[model samples]
Target: MFHNSGKLLFFLGKADRLRITVWLFSLTVITIAVPLAFGNLYPTQAERDVMAQTLSNPALTAMVGPVNFETYTIGTMTAHEMVLLTALVVGLMNILFVNRHTRVEEEEGLLELVRSLPTGKGANMMAVFLHILFINLLLVLLISVGLGVLGIESMGWNGSMLYGMVLGGSGIFFAGITAISAQLADNARTSFGIAFAVLMIAYLVRAVGDVSAETLSWFSPLHLSSQAEVYGANHWWTILPLFGVGILLFAVAGYMASLRDLDAGLLRSRAGKTTASSFLGTPTGLALRLQRTGIISWGIAMLLLGASYGSILGDLETFFEGNEILQQMLAGESSASFTEQFLSLLIVVIALIATIPALMSMLKLYKEEKSHRVDLLYAHPLSRFQFFASHLSIAAVQGLVMFLLAFAGLWMAGVAVMTEPFSFLTIVGAGMAYYPALLVMVGVTVLLIGFFPEKSGWVWAYLLYAFIVLYFGGLFEFPEWMEYLSPFGYVPELPNEDMTWLPLILLSMVALVMVTIGFRGYKRRDLQG
Candidate 1:
């Protein structure tokens, strides 16, 4: 039964011949190649010293998970950091892939055809598991090969094994999560929401525990990935727990899959208010309904991230005080107050966090159009201007909201330590200063939806572009013009530098032009079949 089922999934994934292969290959490269290259580049003693100091900061550890500084091996360090960040990329893949195969297949009205074949109740489960397993195994082998090529020797075979298992386990665990999520929701969107929220919660729990060590980390799979102790202890036993948990989750998911009706979840969705008030008649009103839930969710996430960053800010000075190289990298000049410089770096870090919501909001616009909901929206007397404006309003307002949530979190953390009263508002102002670039990002995404639908199909490209920009700016010494392409480039360096209005105004004008172009082009272009 499992064999036949696996064969079906293998064929189904081949539906997008060029696109799917490219997507997996790209993720494979990112999960493996960048670390290998970085390991080779930073082989010097001075480079290691700078990274050691950076990793010592509490927030860095919280964000990247634990490090094995003593081993001085880049691969081990990469494992620690990639375990957290790669899990994010992998988790999203699992959610999307599983939902595509299971819930989405049924939603498209293809389940009946498949059911007519000689298949059992567990075919779908077996199929999804096999597909995800293949992916995880392939990633493990590719990453191990990449690591070996980097020339950083691991301690015995344990280092390589631990690295592979931790990274691969992340995908396996999330596959199980998506399987359960698929069984719990009728639609792909709802299941994605549930699975993604769990992913966020996992990161948050691990972050909080990293800062406080309150034992809250044990509840999350994230803890398992990092507890492998890559080069430190190379704890072989931890992998068993992750494997055990993933298997149990899959079993439960299989049980639920068998119990649920085709294309249905455990909880039936009840119809809400049938009547639309006067506010719902306006374009903004409808936009609010469509975008409000996402805005609120991102706002809350930013606040939590801000709080996490703030929890470690007080210790950063201590972490970098002894290392002259780190001081130069962080503060730049001794003539200025180191404290002010450190706080400025903190603001830059938080601002980067705030950019995520901006990108997410922009991506939502593409989703709205791709799902074929925009046609219904435009059918109502709403002009193209209204339609475009509605989404732009959502993106701009939500970006601001997320910024404020981050500010609010930082403010609360500051108050707890009885820091200066004005410190919080200053950070908020600095954060708000980046709104123009964020809005431009939203506009860029909108334009992509209209003019380059095929390009927008690759969501991972957005992330990859960002990664390349970041790496080039800091690691490869790229020219300023190339870096300017990233929205983060236009943001004013906060805390340490004075604020400016010129850049913001210019960016706003650019965004307006982009939006105008997208709206006009989309209104005139032929709808895709």
Candidate 2:
């Protein structure tokens, strides 16, 4: 078992995308650093009290966990902000890692090739688990050391260690969950969907539970380690439950892996209808069919987020009133009610999330091409334009669907929760307002795939850059041009500011031109695969 695990680990290491891993790790560090930096910027006791009061807002608490006003220090503030977000980052990493090595390898036929070698039945599974465990260890070390070094005086080593364990332990828990999911679902996408659903459920439960009752938070792995209450009345016992649950999940995953055959999942794929519909033969139909599940997954997540944000609208005014700092900032921007401002800001964030599915749809084209599936399809007399256009169309349509559905969810919540009159047209308009920016994201992905197929994954970095620029640019005091690099920058914050048609028109034109260039490049270039 040791020898087999070692061999498999070497293979996994070789196949891993080191660049992306490093980027993601750096992102985790940056995310942690931002709040610490913000906290440090406001060292006054008065400022800390104000920030702590703001953090206690139900709306804010719903996003992260509740703040401890009793221990209202910079470290506590940093921990309150960083805990959930860092858990999310590490959770995503573990999910992607397990899925890629387990299900994705099986789907791509590499798992079979590895199995043909002198390896034990569970060698591959154990190796992935070991690799992830090692990664989490490194994550713990980095986070602990980084926090200690950056916040030695405020948070202390004990608090830092506890916080690091909270993040790394949650990641380990999710790694085990994803491992089980990989064995249960035949395809990588399905495995990811299942794992993501579990992650979301756990997170939502933690969020709701943390806001309502202290005991309710115990059920979620995300909130389990956070029970340590770093920098306050620290309870070291919380770490025990987290690691214990993680080990149990890992053991269960191994047992499940032993039960399943390679490439055969517990949830077996169903056979398609014997007679194909005529439209199924067309590229557009095929693209839509392939993207249907992905669309639904993204849509559901958007709806959940939108509804959560909407339900909290009743607290927006109260939240603003409690935090004079936020009110001052909003006052400087617009005369609109706090509710409208909150909605406007949140919709932009929703738009950012909506861009993800659109980008994935476009990136799907790259994956298809690299997998040589496109070559096979081209052999069957399909034009390059038709093949390309089909996927791009799916992305565009998916983006529109995501935005509209998200707005619908928010509108429904507003009607349910708010006494004030809510305008459906206003919500629809806000959703539509995001279309051009989303198209620009899709266009950028297409442009990358066409011109730099080998390096197309860099589009993720661009998206991350856009996220930082759009959300933190003002806080960080970035140059106007840097903010402009994000398509969302040009978008008018609708419902607060009157809609501007010119920017939308120009953004649409930019997307069109980008698509044209990308298509032309894809057409003229030699097939990569």
Candidate 3:
């Protein structure tokens, strides 16, 4: 019975339930392609020599890893840069894959049905664990052969082999963490929170330790990825700790699951709301109630993150103090105002930060529709169009409030940096200029949810959207036509460029069109299964 149960789990995964496995291959190729393209872009000896000779600042080393400046070339940057990004992609895959197999399946009743049959306590989990192991193995071979084929075989085979082990270990460790979280939480939502809490802790420990040059990073999974500094001083033994902790967690999770009753979580959830929310009486009220907690949490966190980032502005010069080119690069024209440069960076960051709320707002459409909560709303007086618009209204307005809080946070921090309160409004205005772009993004998610209600969900669209903003717009400097494809691109480069209302109005119009079409589709279709 246990043997067939395990085999059934394997077959289910092979059936392409989420088409999630394909995402792994796609991500691996993209990771390889980014470095491969850059490596080819600068192949000249002198060009490589200049990069190899560039002095490493602590901030730069902390951001990218410690460079072997003498031997460091574009190839090294490619690998080092990928270390962090690759870890992020791999970690995301780990969490989502595990959660999908365990927690989300239980939430949706799939796990309960499977478990009713004769099976081992952690059959599904064993399948998930082994599935990820196979993926990680595939990744190791892919990246190693990929670099070797691309003619960038500059690192020791042993070091490169260790690099692959570290990458696989990183993902597997997070998967084990997710498995532990699945046992603790009663539902997928709580499980996600538990897992994400671990991720946040990992980053905070790693980032703070790196920023302060402390030993705290020794405890974080994120640190293990970049701490080796990849191309420089590759520690071959880091894989052992990651693998050991991950295996320990996996064993503990299986033991806990075996001890628990079927369909029951280790953490018991109790009914709440002895009294009712005032807004619980109406669909709009209920929607607001459902959304307000998320909005408030996001707003405050963004404000705090913005404040933290803003507080660090005056420190950038210190980071680049001895590097004249870097200083000039950041300061931009000794003649240009230093205050403006700092303000520009803050405003841009806060503006991009605002999109997160907008993305969450977009995602709510799926949560409500998929959960059949929207059906409850439709049972009332509201039309489908009205219902969809109501959700859209909350999202759009929430985006405005999110940016406002971000601006307020930046304003509060800017007073210390600007040494005057006058520039607060100036900075806020620049940040606010991003609203049109934010609105358009909100609309895109709404439109997708309205039409392709069953595809990959909001995460895929947001992933693509976010990558373009983070890399293409920020790092690659794409052309205007290409940049305009991103909702963020429609935004004026605040403080760096002057404001224009034409683009804003145009974007607003597009958003209006998207919302109209989205509602039309929602009104025509039945509620999701």
Candidate 4:
């Protein structure tokens, strides 16, 4: 009966055309390629020694899985960097892909139409599974070919194939997780949150395990990708559990689907209040309420990340003591403390990640309008300025609060780990250093909304562009002007470099101008919705 169902290929075609899918896939490939290319560029003993020491750090290992320092070849170097990050990228892909096809379709009233045709009850789920499977398989093939072309001897053909398979396995595992989350949540957004939260927890588990050198890492499916030991032990058995868990979760999703009515979830949603509160009547309050879920999610993640970085600070001195090479790499021939320099850079990274929420909040204006919800809000006494200002303010305020929490995490961890006195002032300054860049990102998103409401989704592409530029530009030796385009490029590197207020103040002014122009432009244009 299922053989005639064309839903599988149909959805695959649909996914193939989506800009989101295409960009994500391309980013994953770039993530792998960039690291591989860099690893091969410097094969000298000094460079390898530096790489070995960097990978040996507890914090770096906690973030990225422990590297096989004994086998720090280009292949292993590539694997060490790519494993954790690529798994995350591919996992997000599956989560988004699955949610779009399943819960999102049901929400948009398209699932009913699909079902009304001569299709089976399981057609949608089956189609989604097939779609995810194809994506992973294609990713595996791409990575294998890319690695082979790079000619990394340590990760020979077999090791490269295993590496690719491990990545694909992680995606497959998360595809099941998101499938189950979709069944449990009443809406697509809620499903994404549920799955994302689970992903974060899994990541933290692996981080804690890697840092403490414990067995907790084995419990996370995310850890499974790294445990495969692609170039080292080459354990093929590690891949079995991914398939096993995926099949079990798919079966459970199908059973759960059978129990629920179409467009409804297995979990019951809470009913809303009968009367709106006085504060809820205000636009700013309304915006805050709308964005609270995302704020909370990003906030917790940031705190966890910050704390992770902090916990390792106390060990930095010890880790650097024996190795003159690592000490020089971390701190140049300067009078400044090594810990401060590392902490400053780490805080900057946290603040950069905090941009994710800032941009999301700014783009919320476009989202509401695109979904036609803004019209309903505007039906009341809400002015355009109120609508725009409220959301942007929330984003700004939330970014500030998120940065503080991150700094607080660092401070708390520092106090816990350090026997000597820790300076809260330095940490606070580092966190605040990112404010200009954060504001600039929000401003850019607003500009996108104001000028291109119909194509406002393109703001995400801008975010990706900025992220890559700020984080990887130096590694890739990108042109200076191109890197300058990222707001982060203007932000001072903090304690590593002297705190310069000129660029910070100038960037702030630019952000202010951008916001003003966006606000004016949005007022003049007809509502896209």
Candidate 5:
């Protein structure tokens, strides 16, 4: 069943080396950087305790995970603050990584070519499993060794290994989930949807369980990973369930794969209507139909994300009232309230989240082109510009709607929780201030799709860079010039700093130029599959 698996593994590694490197490097850097900063940020045990206490509220527990600090050391703080979020990220990485290799390859007909050779029936999957295992192991080694090298007294080598193991276990667990999802869904999109839905459900369940009931958390892989309590009790036993369940799931996925035929799923796809609706006749309508499921999913996610952040807003004033470290990190000026300063930060985050769907919408054009779907459309009455406009327009409109839904969710939840709620219009205006920045991202995606469709993936890299620089710049005290690298940095931190129109206008102009150039490129370029 595993014949030639080594060759397939090497092939996959070669294809995905860059992505694997980025994930491992980013996760390790973040894991190590936090602890390194924590030692200096909260130098004394007293300060660490206060920081832990400030973060112990139900809202934060729901947002990150339950704080498991007994002595409130730097190690405990790092574990509490970083583990759950990082695990969630690692889980997502595994889901995408697995789905891309398994279901996506099958959908694109690559797996079929490999199978025509003398490879075993299960060779491809076995290779994927080995590839994922290798990546997770590398992640574990990098994070563990990186933290140990930091030489933080509280973050000892023993705890560092456990911390890295927790994340590695989480990644393997989610990789198994995606493996099963790949066997269950015929299409790459549906396969990814199923895997991501599971990821989101795990996070939501863990959040609810941590804030409400400890017993419920035991069911969530995310919660189970956090139970490792790396620097606290060093509950080494908690990691067993993650590895065990993951292996079980992998076995189940393998069995399912053996029983099914190539390019087919255990779960059947729904049959479409024999006759087309009038709405599907036009480019805009066709684009909407193709993207509606993703758009709806992103919209719901944005709303919930905004509400989650808003739920914690009521506690921010008290949380930041006396913590000099937090105050200095979040404070903008002497006059800005802590809540306002935090809102400014939150808006940057919300805007960035909103940008994803917008970017996805624009990138759909490239996906269609790569799949040769655009070729068929061009045979009809559709022009390249019309096809391009359809996706771009949807992206633009959906981006605005995302902001509105997110801000609306934020306002509704915030009003219920705060003693003195902020004005709805104020929050909306503050959020909308970042809309132009979102357009800048959309423009970049459009530019990539027009001129460099094969390299469309680079847009996501740029977005990730923008997120890190803009979101963590203040926390890391990144240089001021670094902020200007992303459009989000151009906008004033509204409601904390005075709103500036010049930056917004400039961002809009930049977006316009990119879109215009992308349109011209799309019109002139020969179609490639």
Candidate 6:
């Protein structure tokens, strides 16, 4: 059953080496950097205690798991603030990694080609398992050593090791979930949908459990990792359930894979209508239909995310009152309230996130083109301009709607929680100020899909870079020019700083030029498939 599994594992590693490296490096850097920063930010025990007390509110407990304020050292603060959030991100990474290798490869026919050779039936699945295991192991080693090397008083070697193990355990648990999802769904899209849905459910369960019911939190893998309590109690035993359940799920997936035929799944796709509606025949209608599920899902998620952030706004004044580090970050703005400054920061991050679905909407055209589906549409009278414009228009409009939903959610929730809420119009204006930056992102997507179709993935990489620079630049004291590298940097931080029209206008014009050039390239270039 495992014939040539070693060779297949090496092949898989070679194929994904770059992606794996980037994820590992990013996660490791963030994990280590946070503790180092915390040490400098809260040098005195008094500041740490104040921060801990401020974070003790129920809103934050729901967002990040409960804090261990008993000790309240740098390590404890790091664990309180970073562990649950980092675990959530690591779970996402594992889900995407597993789904990409398993279902995505199968959809692209790469697995079929492999099977035509002398490989055993179970060789490919075994290779996938080993690949994921290797990646998780490397992550564990990197984070543990990285933290230990920092030599912080509270973050000792043993506690660092426990922290890394918790992260690795959460990742493996999600990888197992995605593996099972791959076996159950026939296509990559359905497989990804199922896996992500499970991830969301886990997070919501954990959030609810943390706020109200301690026993219920035990059901969530995220909560299990939090239970480890690294740098505090350092409950090493809490990690057992994660690994145990993860391996069990992997075994169940392998067995299911062995029983099923190639290119098929346990859950069958439902049959479509025999006769299509007239609207489905048009380019705009077709694009909307293809992307409807993703748009709706992203919209709801953004709304909920905004609400989560909103829940904590009422406590920001207390959270930021005596924190020297945060005050330094916002030193330029003495006139604005701390909550407003924090709101500006939150809007930037949220806008960056809202860009994902917008970009995906446009990139779907490239995906379809690669699959040769676009060739059929071209066989009819549809013009390149019409097809391109349809997707571009949908992306632009959806981006705006997503931003609004998030802002609306934030405003509604903030009003409910705050004794004296800020103006609704102020929040709306602040959010709308970032819309031009969002357009620039959509324009960049168009530029990529138009000319460098094969390298469309670069947009995501650029987005990641933009996020790091825009979100962390101030905190890290990066050079001024670094902020200009991202579109979000050009726009004024709203409600805190007065709105300026020149930069926003310039951004919009830049987007217009990029879109125009992209359309021209699309018209000239040959179709991919």
* Best candidate, TM-score: 5
Model 6 TM-score (2 dp): 0.96
**Worst ten-residue run, lDDT, model 6?**
325-334
**TM-scores of all predicted structures:** 0.84, 0.92, 0.84, 0.89, 0.98, 0.96
- lDDT tens string, model 6, 371-459? 77888898999899989988999999999999999988888989988888878888877888888888888888888888999888778
Query: What is the C-alpha lDDT profile of model 2 across 1-529, one tens digit per residue?
Result: 4348888887777767575477447756675666556664576768778778777777677777887547677777777776787788778888988898888888888888887888877788789878887788777777778778874466788887887778778888888889888888988899999999888988888888878877777777777545567767667777676567777877787788788887789887889999878898899888788878888888889888889878877756767765544554342467888888777777887888888888999999988877677777889989998999899888898888889888888888888878884799998798788799889888888888889988787777787788777666555556779968888888888788888899999999999999999989989888876
Report the lDDT tens digits of candidate 5 across residue range 204-304: 99999998898888778888766888877888887888888887888899899999999999999889999889989899999999888888888999999
The local distance difference test score of each candidate is 0.69, 0.79, 0.67, 0.77, 0.87, 0.86
Q: What is the lDDT, from 0 to 100, of the residue 332 in candidate 5?
A: 50
Off by over 4 Å in 3: 1-8, 11-22, 33-76, 116-119, 291-293, 315-353, 373-386, 410-422, 456-459, 462-466, 473-479
Off by over 4 Å in 6: 328-332
For residue 249, model 6's alpha carbon misses the true position, in angstroms, by 1.4
Tell how far residue 288 is off in model 6, in angstroms.
1.8
Clashes per candidate, residues 3 or more apart or on different chains: 0, 0, 0, 0, 0, 0
In candidate 3, which residue pairs get closer than 3 Å at backbone N, Cα or C atoms, i.e. clash? none
Which scores greater on lDDT, model 5 or model 6? 5
Ranking by lDDT: 5, 6, 2, 4, 1, 3
Kindly report which residue pairs in candidate 5 clash with one another. none
Mark the regions of model 5 whose C-alpha exceeds 4 Å error after superposition: none
TM-score of 3: 0.84
Candidate number with the higher lDDT (3 or 4):
4
Q: C-alpha displacement of 49 in model 3, angstroms?
A: 9.3
Candidate with more favorable, higher TM-score: 2 or 3? 2
Off by over 4 Å in 4: 1-12, 15-57, 67-70, 112-120, 211-213, 317-337, 419-422
